[model samples]
Target: MGETNVKLASINPDAQKARDLLRIVIVGHVDHGKSTLVGRLFHDTGSLPDGKYESIKAMCERRGVPFEYAFLMDALQAERDQGITIDTSQIWFKTEARDYTIIDAPGHKEFLKNMITGAAQSDAALLIIDAAEGVREQSRRHGYLLHLMGVRQVAVAVNKMDLVGYEQEQFDLIEEEYRDYLRSIGVEPTFVIPVSAREGDNIANGSKSMPWYKGPTVVKALDSFLPNAPLVDQALRFPVQDVYKFDQRRIIAGRIESGRLKVGDTLMFSPSNKTAKVQTIESWSAREDFTPPSEAAAGQSVGITLDEQIFVERGELISHVEEAPIETEVFKARLFWLGHEPLTAGKSYKLKLGTFDTPVTVQKVDRIIDTSDLSNSESEQVERNQVAEVTIRSRRMLALDEFTSNGRTGRFVLVDKYDIAGGGIISMEGYADQRAMIMATKSTNITRVEHGVSIEERARRNGHKGGVLWFTGLSGAGKSTLAVALEKLLFEKGYNSYVLDGDNVRHGLNANLGFSPEDRAENIRRVGETAALFQRAGMLAITSFISPYRSDRDRARAAAGDGFHEIYVKADVETCKQRDPKGLYKKAIAGEIKEFTGISAPYEEPDSPNLVIDTAETPLEECLETLVNYVERNFRV
Candidate 1:
């Protein structure tokens, strides 16, 4: 960072027009000389502030200590005393090719989350490895995270080569091993060079001691990184950061996250589903009055006024309406856990994406990924520092784009209580019709069917009112037996009815689903939608399933809308074990089954069921009579 680029940019007006800029992050393990390398880069570029170098050198001389180059980045006196970098610090430097912003991230395990924050914002990265230590755990973990964040350009610096006697053989071994690991994670290193940051070899100049090794200096390698292509060809996604009203006009303010914004372009705000035309652009300046620029590209901060007054607010994404974001309550994401507590299903966290924040729950954990070798396995939870593919459900609707499509609107962070517990990227969308598929039908302009035969007519012909009776209980609780008996009794009475058995559906409609909690919820979802279809044809839909979770059952009821009956065909664990005809209870008790609800996992009892039949005590005839009488009273129109 020269004095001109660091402090005298305004005075040198010509330099401001040079828009070639790139941001890169320096990451590595603790005590691996990341700060030293950044300090060396700044020193060699003459970017340090005036008197900054002399003061540091004088301090080292007075203390009778060798001046440490890493001290330049560890600004805190306590940090220098402790010999570690605590937080991410941004330092500006320039090469003739481009202006560079280097984000020096802490390499400590505790601050790995902080490192993610900086890496997520970078266009490229420099991974520094210690030659003496070879490849460390963080060397792989950090590289994996960089790949996860979509940073493909990387340059690895093998530092502290002087400590290894500047041996070419030592550099080759370390270089080959680390390069192979990068290939496994789908990253081809732009360059890997051995350097001694402390001795200033292979940094800004060539090294004579290691004449056998030949490669571009670290500065040249960084310059070789390609600049980010212009995002103008992409769609506009200017997320609203805030709305400000200085005196009279309300200005929607935020950085253009991607694409471009210009006056007179029609824009639509997402999640809010509001639209307005951009009337004028506004920018702040030192002058009393200034002309607003005609356009604002990505990375520029500008405000705009709409032609007509609208309820514009934060958390709303701005884009062209024709290519709007997907507003949904459910999505799939790959998340990296960082909280003290492991990420568990059913627990709630706050998710913040762009300017939007909402309550989030890990509805299902598909699998946990081992960062070291990229192997994956089925996991019930993701522990701290672990990565996993999971399904997340939000309390309210959020407009999101897949990270493969748009990086800014596709990223999110999970906050457990007040601290950020994890971060993820949106991968797949669910409930695409609206926030919730069942709820969106009420808002859409979908043309309602005008059937030639009315629902009343169909019920009259069938001699019964349309309804759904959901039977839930523990396995071997006689739910299916009772449902079969009810179907016979109802059919004998000449009333239209049908039965949906759990295992029967799994054999066909839900054949692709597994026994995972997520699959179970989806199974119930499919059954609920199917049962509703039967009710639409004036039939009594009797569904027999364990239906473990109350949340899943509630969604079923909500989808049914009305005439939804929740009957708990209750039985104690011991009684179900005694009556285990299929022997599932024996397997579950012997630990042969995974995610076996009511034995291994959970079975949320309904708070207020329409009916409860304790099959262990209630007589078969008595239970049948109770259900028959209840149905006649409710559905005998």
Candidate 2:
């Protein structure tokens, strides 16, 4: 029972597996008694390892220090003497209502990242204010932080009541000041109860010392915290972590961030645009006799074997075919800067959102908010511990959702050098984030590119409507073949058209790019923008790429403006392998190539396409006729 180096209490398996488990984090300023409150909760709930409490008490006695509940949180005697938690720690505690995992977050401003790490993973938070100290700067800062991290349910614990002689007046004053600041930031506390974490008064049970108080005890208040809204109701967002090829079975392992996934479900990977059907629902110890789960919902780490082995890699987001996340590079975010240096505009930092890690720059400092006093104003740069609204421009397009849409996938961190310097929740698309590129285009246009040619003018001049014919599907799915043959048909028929074949375009235009998720996004972006320019000049830009990610295809459609048609060249894996004109699927199957689409990587089919040509079934002449006829009826006179 005497567990040493215990991060979590050994709880009953039944309690551990309960669906009512809630993750609550204790956060506040240094020496404000966050650890002590949590330690008291654990000890009172009978959650501590046997003799662990007594050992801490004995150590405090031998060192001539008073035995405090806070002592149980600090591993080293020096840490307790210093009266500050240096790192984040988690402890398991159960109550009459539900089980809890209380995260102890350090309160020191320097350890802000540690606190943020804890707060980010939490469902709710208990913000502590030292009654004796009477509303310090860190108290206001932490409270404001909890709001930014989207911890909606916060209760203020007016700790150290014994030091204030258990006076109700002292508790009232501190609660009033903190409550006003919290209101300014749009947060209302659930409760502001006075407590002495050291003496364990008003903790598990109500305090008799404060006879005027008639509210719930610490335990009662904590038990009132509601369980988080289940992510099953939302759209799916599973970012691939790693692909495991153990023996002959290739399993894509990841946690479902939102929605549910079932066997035989069709999944589309974003930014890569790869498609696969769930062949099997796999767990770590899954066997032939394994009873498949009905469906793996949000928060479950699962390994899924696809019907077709499409090269899915880390950074690609798996989504439902009907619904997909947005893909963009420029977005607005509300971030709290924790870097030692100020977050200055024009400086590049690595922005990690889900599996997408790309170098990003602070294009504009919209404004900065000082959490210390809730004072906000427009600023040129964001300093340490200051929250700010800024425009971020990533090096490549990233699949993303608004924080309000999905917190797990919607938040990102800014890495300066090697350390994670800032964290933020994406607010919305920063259309202004494209300012730098726009200004550059303006500056470099010796020919003075103009938007004088209207859509109608372009269409009339082209003889056929000017637009993009975007062929998307797996490699060797006849996308390039169809696009080339279609271009030949249109050319001989005396209409302005050109084929931007994936291979030929890559050789010249995207020679610097590779097949990674980031590179693929950039490659598509360039092709899309280039196709748009060609379309504007009244030419039908027929572009063919695997373009497996829906989000990327959507972005390409966006760039091409109106009349961008998506064509799905349908072919199953076996058919595509048999027609492996490039010998890529064979190499990928043999493990000679990594992240190769249609074999190891994913090829997401168009969720809804203008046309679906079964290349495996239809003859080349018939496929050509169907494709050309559709284009003529839709785009021709």
Candidate 3:
């Protein structure tokens, strides 16, 4: 030690109450001395319980093994036996400046899940690197994981300096390499210092071994980190945990994850699109005569009563109407997978966000990321411990925020069967929020007029029932080809039918619409409404368009109701491009066309379609016969 060691202070109860507490997780490659560092910090600060150190030394003596600092932190029998940490261990620590909770996270590759659990709860991180080994692959992986988990404040400790003769050159090399790696992932390390944990050098005091080095000790670096500010300024994200009834009063109970709310504030619950005003903010206090709280903010578990009774359930997000979360069935995610089975596209899993739970399918595995090198590669499935960027689709709309906007409501976990298999943060780079669009109906004075002629009478006059044959797929998947043939055959069979091709409709009904997502949605809205009217008129409205989004098609289904039939025109992108019926695919691939489905843009496959026409393998005549038989069998009334 560089300075005279003062007598260690005992943990003062009075000081603990007034001081801010910070949770710091120590992580790195296995055998990088994370445990030894933790053990030394306790001994240097004199925070260990009386007789706990002596007992641990005695246990090592009885076992006929040399005493090591790592034994102090590896308290579990399994850990001591294996000489490796397998789970997370939380212990209290204190510096002269603040009270601290030290979370010792496992650094082994197989115990990555335990590491993630620890990191997710931490406010900052202390990453250890073995000087002799320098930056290993696991070190890079840990850095990426920390970034993925949103741990921004980081300090790097180049431990085992004694093994390398406390050389400044070696420490500097490791620091520079690892620093560049962290910065590549958008993490700027606050400090990087060389220390010997076992010798108690540069931990609580300055290091005498390295006279040329001048920096704050590990304790000083930790004390300098500030606590995260309260989330009062962010948008409201109150996820309903449960609903309770007492004396004919229904109270919505949940933890306010962000923002503040007062009585009389209007709240909009999402996925249901219902609204209510907060009548009372209920909180339990020790005093019996305590009146309800006038307001509540983030980190408070509260119950609120609404001014009106409405149907609400767990997992509904509550927000102010003006700044509500995005409601969409699909969104992009960057996730770290920990499942035993590979995460493949088209596979379904249960997603848990806040209290919201819904079944979601992996629509596309965009790319597999190599964390150690930060390289990307295309893969159909993401293996265990692999990170991937993927598109996830839920059958129903979910209310969520972008992780950058609000982390508490944007992060989620994936459950496979019964186990949590993966976790991720949400991003909406190219996708729309859809909250405003979904709730944009402004009609106030309109009436639906029932026709005098019954549906049965119309069906009898047309010689068949009516329907909207919705054809959806990629651009060159033979939708127009099959739809027109089906319409002609149905007409020859004495059934009233019409073909609404994409180009033909765009030239007239949707002439005003552009190719933007919002315009495309509006175009589909108009087409769905028109097709439904045609269905009501006892005619088969055959629609052919590259309706790529599942949500858009679902809206069309809702408009047409039971008379809607979704026909999937199936063809792989490569096959469709090879056919190049209209040369659109060539233009899309050549960058002449923007936002082209199956090329530059996305094409969502239907989860379940009424019928599938495989144009690549099936002949045109056979495909036509399948269509004709389906219409004749179902439409004949």
Candidate 4:
């Protein structure tokens, strides 16, 4: 991948002469004049090779077809015959200020993947729209793709103005409509200019036909877009590609994605929390006894030896000790699916991000977004060529970063079987970075004090073994009601039992925490630890809370070990809303409450539970009897 990125820069031979080279991708609806605009830009800027224009004109005459600037870019005979671009094409042109590599991507729906391939490497974008036909569905889809791919610098070209008679009203209407759509999706167009790509109006020079219009020409806009900031100034992201051995020295090699590294700098490997100082920076050289460089910056591929040997492998991210990436087992992603089969929930796929690879499952399908109309719909599966937001889960903790935080490490592709099925950008919106919590040590001088009483003695005195019965479900699902009733029954039957209701604990123990996802995880963590202690003291701890995230629930299970029992109180959202015990559902539906589970927030159901009580359908007496029997069979001394 690093070698491929190196080739992208050398495509433009004039790169050495210009101060900066900006890669721009052009996309639009089919027949929106994207090719014509690109060809015209090259011709008007005098960047076309000698005799390249006349040769195309003669070919057009021999075929008895009209001459079109688009023919210059549609070089493939098959593309000219079909009159639609089928693949991505690259061209080089220059303005007085800087050089440009214009990537002309296909505008057809069937070729959208090719378009994504071209746009993914671009620094900025140029979106073309037809003035006469207005903004079509494909035009809106292309705009959304640019936003998803993280291209912020964009310019809109209202092409084929000749067909619209160079009227300012038509251009204004189209501009207003498209500008509103782009803004809704968090994209702001830098410029909106009207141009006739075939006639070369407003492309390289001002248009006299449209006297009332005032905007920079296409060439001027290309020159005005600023180059991206130097990647060396950002946080370090060095993903290990391989570990090598040379003359009894173990060297780790990788390309620096961002920031810099020098000898003696302490580097931390994420997801493992291992740290080592850089002993030496190694590079390939032909001459013997060559002096190795002491430092390396972003875009350089170099090897290094650690001060001391430790277990290290490929796919671990290397960063400064204080600026490490996020270590998490799950994250939210916005991805585009291109697989033959629809992307469905609970399906497993291989996720490839940077040098890391892991088996990930689709935890849930959040929503499918219609790029054409910008409407969201809940669907069980994402069809081919559709964009969807979904939750992804890995089997274990993985090192990564949020796309918004670090694009290089956060972007990933999903491999279905052996085929590349989808691509996405990562967002840790509702998830926690568990590195600090996992590695944190509150006190170093303290030791765990062992209890004097034996477990068997405590069980004999309490008449039952101590354990945690964790009831999890949506609000108004009868979790608290069932838990309290069970607590009373267990106490009357000569067993020590207590109920830890969500609201009751929130009033005191969790008073400092809010309903945010992060706070909720922390709350669950505290409750799990407290419940484990209760069990150790020979008491049955029944806990009731709407634990929405699976990872948090898993943490609670880990805390209690074999003493945890997951009791799923199953009830659909409609049933829960209909049985609003505390009127919380009504408030949530009326917008008075935000981030309420089963309404504004998400609730991930337990994949496998020890007990599933269908409170929505079963009678209270029968449910209580079933719970009593299960406890008698398992927990009785």
Candidate 5:
């Protein structure tokens, strides 16, 4: 073991306060010793509990699992059983200079979603490359993801030195190759360490096996890391996370993305376009008019009290009044697709960027770039784990910042109706006009075929204004029956209502659609758009479908906009079979209908639905009453 040195001057108590904590995530191909390296570091620093190692070792032996360094990182039982890291495991350790939180990210390609979640929160990354195997697919994939996530700092660790006979030549060759690869993607490693994590060589202690190489140990290199300061010192960016109202005072809790914020400063809330003066800087401790923004820079969570009771919500940005935020409906972004399904033009998905969640569609498949070849591929779609430069058009305006400027506001994820399928970074903002121009060029002939009445006027004539009532459930479930029943009931009550059933739309509106995942997506998209139009016309639109995919439901919600109401007619598959509204379940089980939802295809229940009616338990009258009350509360007369 190398002699440990303590530099008291290097350890500053105010160091943690000076800037946001720099998070470094360790990512690499599986079995490359990422977890082992972390465990070794923890073990050397005395961070792990006393009997934890012994217990893990005993468990590994009993399970007949190969006791590698990665076993220490198998925190989850699933990870251990699968012999892979399924999720990112956060571990905190203290060095002589700073307190570091190391995120151990999984390297499996299937778990890229987990990797993105971990990398998004990191300021820096540690790329672990196995010297024996060189760079694998995950190593390259994660590298691209990190770059897309705006992680500026990176370090490379060449593990398994003992297997390579602790040869300096092998380490040098691998280092040069990886350096070239990273440099191509605009990332330069700070340091590369060659050490045997199994033998405790040069990780925390200096290794005698490799005497020719002379460089700082991994721990020393980490301590030497200096955080990058924010660019604009005068510009304050506060992204409101939540509003807390206690008694008579309203407190806004958010992290300052950039610049200085102080009490008595006038701040402007965007999207809502409201202005208010800062009353006081509220935190665990009460501060006066002198709240130094420098004292709490970007990424540091803080609370603020405003002078006026202005309406604000999570995802809204509050900044200095002079530099009001820009909101746009369309933008150009660099996207990395991770879903099993490919990303195609005209496909809709839920766009979750910052705190704003909206319905978005891919207007065009701009260009697909192969990360490995660095060449353009002329393809109609982007497949799983592929990186591409594409343009996205959102239904509503979103306040966005460039990836180079502010990562917090620039990064976004595309949820396939329910599951997050892709992650992207906003490269350019305010591309709505460009998209409009493209749309104009595509439409050679323009014809005015007005319905002769405005949507508001039509709704007024209908008695009850237009809105979308989405019904979701299992295949054999009474979603369609209930939807039709409700529409008839609304019609009898002097409300104009229309039913958009799966069977009805398949005959004409969705005639081109098939039972495939892609076709199902298109089916949902068409229904959602139609419902939106009906709602605009002031007619109640009831859509009933076995929209098994959550992503499809999310897209419908976004298309329907503010008046969209999602109702989950919750019923078990067994109960659905008992109902057998269309005799579809029997066909599905008898192999007559392939890709039938609730049989072959999956049905993801809505996570945050507006209403949930258990058709199995609730009476028809009671369910109808509950739905009526919801409509009355949500839709104003």
Candidate 6:
């Protein structure tokens, strides 16, 4: 659009300085002109690196592809070959008034996971729509995702105006429809511009072609756009990314998402929930008394030194003692399934929220929304690229907030076994209010078989208290053998003890379970819950299993609570086969068992085990002695 006196020089420098740089991501369906808009903006602003345009131009000619504007931003070879942006690309440009970091996101549905990754870091969004095509499936879906991601600021760039004959009616019609759609989902676009990115009309510079429709060019609109500052003055919330100890100082570095952080200010760390006073505020050789939530706020990296030597770690949030963050065991969230496989309930996966990664299970699927109609559908499971409202139960208690309130801590990604399959944002907290919903679904039936009293009371009764001795090793590595020996030793010491061997569980408890990855996850979940019950009943629960996945072990650790002790029954695979107590390894080699741990499947060794017994070199009694000693040291009252 053409607007007079809207030159770049007219922008206010003070406004630019006060506002933090908002990184906006432009995303839409394939052939939606996302790249062209970015390329035009760069060309209009004279920010294209020298010789880059000519290089892309020559490559396009040699490759027999058209010298299109999209080629300018397609840096990846796969993108150039496929004629589609497969990965998100970042480009830095400036308007007269403000600096902008534009992220060009991939448009293919297959790469939607990558798109979400890019969206996770963006402050706002620019949704591109084709004027002639109106709104496509991806155009609507991406907008929905942006809303779900909590990107409140949006602008629709209706491209291909030249193809539509620069018609005012076409632009207005598309804008009106999209605005209605946005309103339905609680999103409102600040501006809607009609432009031909290919022709460089009404982008960085105003075009003479659109005289009938007068509005600020894309660049001018961006420059004039005011970004909301971080609420640093309100309650302080700092999520610690890391705590480093150098020389004598303890340095904590993280983004302060909401409140202001200053030197000498006292902050409480969660999970541990310890309070520590800030010693100094430091960033890039600049020391200050206070730092506001500007572009320079929470998103920008900062470091601080605290006065106390508290037990602070990564994944813990720091806040004012008064507001103290909420810690919960289970919550409801809206997840977008991006994996090839369907997301099924009761399946355990790695849940990564903020900097914390723990095992979690999808308890139930509440409702699945069809992207085309934006209507809710009753579904048993959500397939790839589908969005669903699901209830998730974390293995460990987590500190989280609503996505609308705090995007940083509310968002989470689900890692299926090894691959990250989907992501979600916390929509509602506490338990679901629907009693019927809970009744319709099956509970995680962990048998609470009480021989007499509860584990806590029993531990108090027995002179030597009860706790879980988690034994992890290869199938034939004597995990069960050692556990049985330890159980007898504990029993002889007048302690109530029970050994939950893998084979024994498979016979009764996990009778329906198989060796598949999904089944393995369930197996571990059941075992963890059982161990938790046993620990509560004051009985020494010795669980011996491959356990295979680190996420599974982490879940067991959480379920076992404070008295959980992990013992690595370390033995090489070859040595394990030499023993071959059940000859299962031999059968596995004969293809009798598929997805066997240490063979077809993976086994993640505990990185920081409390006890490591090398059964390969050490004798049985020696290994048991080491484990018993370690357990006695940590769990003895």
How do the predictions measure up, each by TM-score?
0.75, 0.67, 0.83, 0.90, 0.61, 0.61
| Count of clashing residue pairs in every prediction | 1, 16, 0, 0, 6, 9
Which residue window of length 10 is worst by lDDT in model 4? Answer: 3-12
Q: In model 3, where is the ten-residue run with the lowest total lDDT? A: 1-10
> What local lDDT does model 2 show for residue 586?
88
Candidate with better TM-score, 4 vs 6: 4
lDDT of each: 0.84, 0.81, 0.88, 0.88, 0.76, 0.77
Cα lDDT of model 6 by residue, 26-116, tens digit: 8988888999889888878878889878888898889887888888898888887788999999898776677788889998888998888
Clashing pairs in 6: 20-295, 232-259, 232-260, 294-297, 454-537, 455-536, 455-537, 455-538, 456-536
Choose 4 or 6, whichever is better by lDDT.
4
By TM-score, rank the candidates, best first: 4, 3, 1, 2, 6, 5
Specify the poorest-scoring 10-residue window by lDDT in model 2: 1-10
1 versus 3: better TM-score goes to = 3
> Stretches of candidate 2 above 4 Å error?
1-19, 76-78, 285-294, 429-637
The runs of at least 3 residues in candidate 4 whose Cα sits more than 4 Å from the true structure, single-residue gaps closed, are 1-18, 48-68, 71-83, 286-290, 445-447, 507-511, 578-594
Model 3 quality (TM-score):
0.83
lDDT of 2 at 77: 53
Poorest 10 consecutive residues by lDDT, candidate 1: 1-10
Best by TM-score: 4
Candidate 4 Cα deviation (angstroms), residue 109: 1.5
Clash pairs for candidate 3: none
Please list the residue runs of candidate 5 whose C-alpha ends up more than 4 Å from where it truly belongs after superposition. Answer: 1-21, 54-68, 230-234, 242-260, 280-305, 429-637
Give one digit per residue, the lDDT tens place, for model 2 in 51-163: 99999888878889787888777776567657779888888888879888888899999998888888888988888888899888888878877888888898889998999
Over 4 Å off, model 6: 1-20, 58-66, 231-234, 247-258, 280-306, 429-637
For candidate 4, lDDT tens digit of each residue in 106-212? 99988888898887878899999999899998898899989988889999999999998999999999999999999999999999999999899999999999988
